[model samples]
Target: MEREFRICSECGKIMFEGYVIEGGWRYYCSDTCLEKNYTRDEFNEMYGDGDTETYYTEW
Candidate 1:
């Protein structure tokens, strides 16, 4: 199997595992990174107004 590495959208850290990918397919290693990469307003604009749980859970 090939390894998958993702760079954190905020910190540019190389991630071998845990990921918090955004709707636009941006990769983040943690909630901190995700938050830093986007604001609440930006998230809503990109994903629409709704509970964020669904956003993280569905993927």
Candidate 2:
């Protein structure tokens, strides 16, 4: 049982869920934070329910 910690690219909050977008490597703690950087349509085309696990963040 291993839970990874991640940081929200939008609010800089710590997240227990280790999910992130591929290629660009963008990460968000919630949909609100994700939507800030991507349009609804764009996000839909991205890695849904993804995994880029860790306590890492891309600025």
lDDT of 1 at 49: 50
Model 1: residues >4 Å from true position, as ranges?
20-24, 38-59
For model 2, give the 10-residue run with minimal summed lDDT: 50-59
In terms of lDDT, model 2 sits at 0.62
In candidate 1, which residue pairs clash? none
Please provide, for model 1 over 1-59, each residue's C-alpha lDDT reduced to its tens digit, 9 standing for 90 to 100: 76767676678887764434454367766667767767756655655554332144312
RMSD (Å) per prediction: 4.8, 6.3
Best by TM-score: 2
Q: How well does model 1 score by local distance difference test?
A: 0.58
Cα-based TM-score, every candidate? 0.46, 0.63
Task: Write candidate 2's Cα lDDT for 12-57 as tens digits.
Answer: 8988763376643656787788778877777666644444232224
Query: Local error of candidate 2 at 56, Å?
Result: 16
